[model samples]
Target: MIREGVMNQAQKLLAGLKIPALQAPMFLISGPEMVINACKSGIVGSFPTPNARTPEILDQWMAEITEQLSSAQNPAPWAVNLIVHPSYPRLEADLQVILKYKPPIVITALGSPKNVVEAIHSYGGVVLADVVNTTYAKKAASAGVDGLVLISAGAGGHTGYLSPFVFVNEVRQWWDGAIVLGGGISTGKNVFAARAMGADAAYLGTRFIPTKEALCVDEYKQMIVEASSDDIVTSDAITGVKANWLRQSLLNAGLDPDNMTAKGKIDFASNGADNKRWKDIWAAGQGVSASESVSDVSSIVNLLAREYVSAASELTQTLKPGNRE
Candidate 1:
């Protein structure tokens, strides 16, 4: 996604961030506390609009996020994700809430963001579209979004198939605005690597799922802490969309990971049955192995900041003219 003025808007948005990253929005998992904490911790915090249960709740959540962030010292900006797909019954209603809150950033998923681009831009909001392939990326760029969140291979729920390296390189050829790469990004070194790969930021979701502010139960977080890359299974059987899930979670939900088949459909309705399925069969990315334990958002961010600095320093020394082989 790209636009003339949007490039400036993206710069302003990124300028306030302590790190070049976003706490990728998660359905039913991310909420106000998570968003607030993530922002306060010097990174963009976000959650899907549907997580609020209704448009009114969405309004409340936005208000809460804005109100809390208002007084924080040097807090990073916050974002809200919207399901712009025509089939989503709440698109119009959610847009209304979004317009009122005017979050610094708005992320669109599951459809073209063209419809809401003008509205969001009218309020000086940056619109970033979630795309998994080059086709979607081109379409979103044409639609004039401020940026594109590339959901590459190894992402958790509603995953992408392309490797981050290939996806970022392909998109960078034509779109140089802002590319936030999501998938298998859990550590600070990964964040630095995203920049090295020509991405503006790293989109992290699974790494934060076990954080204290996440809405999931303790058991889900525990499972993430215990799992590894080998324990991740990709299948559309659960949500009718290709997604990564914890192998043990699938078995716990009585579905064999190896033979998993589409059983549920995509539905963003707050009370949709799909919610139950997601709640029961937890989703996580291959990066689960990096999570050592459940921790606070601030602590995790601090750790990432430390690791990012360390990685940058190491790379700098390695690239020195004298050190190079």
Candidate 2:
């Protein structure tokens, strides 16, 4: 049976959405400004704990997010992503900050959520596990998470290999809780398609990387604007896990996209050596083509809302008796 508190918190997170989507927790790209703007624009905003660089900074970020969202008009809920892997040196320190602030939703990645679920649930907060495949999905479900973020193929950063179609359908067979489909989803029509495929919400990361509020540099944003699906190359060289990267950024960093052979070790420590490397080698998914310009979070959301409505209307027409040819 689904835990009542977990289920309720999940529903509460979804209740305020203008669109069934989440501004995915990007590593260095997301911050207080992005989260605040995204919440104000009517979708869940989130950032990884590692983005703060320290627990004190995380405390300040959560405080600012809560203070701002509380004053905003009908702001959607905000989420915090945590690297629950034991090897992450700051996991305990980060979790303490999380407990003190109590973000409405906590997304756990890189490890089991079991270590932090009870503490988060104690404050009526919900936990969503980021799983790349059905095996991880089932394990997370058994760990008592409120939802699963299926990081399928074509996603940015550390991505999954399974197609969303295959992943979502396979997971739905056993789990009835929330399912947030991620991977190459950068448009409202993509969001609508996710819902049509039985996902409760769409998870978007690369789409938001070029926004004004993103912490990334101007050149990074510019690359995302100029990029297409073919520009994204997947390799485990940068982060020791399979993730998509912009081809040009790899070249700029002096690494050949086609010939990268270094399988870097995975380390989530706040002070890890790879931090500087990530800054130079940018990550983006196949959906980078959708970002035609550098815009504000509000404008992006507004455009997405319009596209979502149009897509829904078109679908309605297509399903009408005379139009179904």
Candidate 3:
């Protein structure tokens, strides 16, 4: 009965996204402006709760996004990303902020979200657990999470090793619940492809990094424009987890891109490595290849919508009138 309840709640929350897409909450990239504008464009917008410098700022960001959405003629719900890991000393504190605001959706990553699922559900909020493989997917589903975010290989941050084609099908084999796929999903074609592959929605990040609403520096945006799939390097040196980052950022920090090592386990409470961290050296997905320059959130979403319609129309023509794939 609890699973059934969560399943309905997950679908209800996601249904608010008119375009069937949700922006991925990237570290140091997602912020209030980004989330607000994206929601205004009829898609789910989101930011990690930890992105705020302090608890006060986190509260302010949540309030601003909520107020703006409430006043809009037609707006989609927003989401918050919570690091459920213990090393994050602010996890409990951030959860309190979420409880106060009760954002429509909460996405948990990096640790067990069992307790978080219960707390969020108590307030009628939806919880989506982030997983890289079937092992984590089964565990999260058993914990009563409303949905699962399949972070396959080519994803920007702390990526999974399996391909999306393999991982999505494998997860669907066992769970019939809501599943959103994330990896190198950048284009409108990719968004349509995700739905065709049995995903409820596409989780996108790298493509949004170059938007004006993002909080990153100018150079970071340019680097993303200059990057391609080959320029990305997966290494655990920065965050103590194997994440995809720009190869040039590592070279800029004076580290041998091929031979890098971490001196200690990562502390989620603080910025990654003391000397070189995400602030300087950045992380992005293989999807950067599709990104060319910076633009506003509205324009970007408009472009994706046009592309999605065109691609869907093209795909529709391939099948016979009365036949299904």
lDDT of 1 by residue, 121-225 (tens): 999999999999999999998998988999999998999999999999999888868889999999999999998998889999999999889999999999999
Candidate 2 wrongly placed segments (more than 4 Å): 1-8, 322-325
The candidates, ranked best first by lDDT, are 2, 1, 3
* lDDT by candidate, in order shown: 0.90, 0.90, 0.86
Error of 1 at 209 (Å): 0.8
For model 1, the stretches where C-alpha displacement exceeds 4 angstroms are 1-7, 322-325
Decoy 1 TM-score against native: 0.95
When superposed on Cα atoms, how far off is each prediction in RMSD? Answer: 2.3, 2.5, 2.4
| lDDT per residue as tens, model 2, 13-76 | 7745999999999988999999999999999999999889888988999999999999999998
Candidate 3 lDDT (Cα, whole model)?
0.86
Clashing residue pairs, candidate 1? Answer: 237-261, 237-262
Among all windows of 10 consecutive residues in model 3, the one with the lowest summed lDDT is: 1-10
Assess the local accuracy of residue 46 in candidate 1 as a C-alpha lDDT between 0 and 100: 95
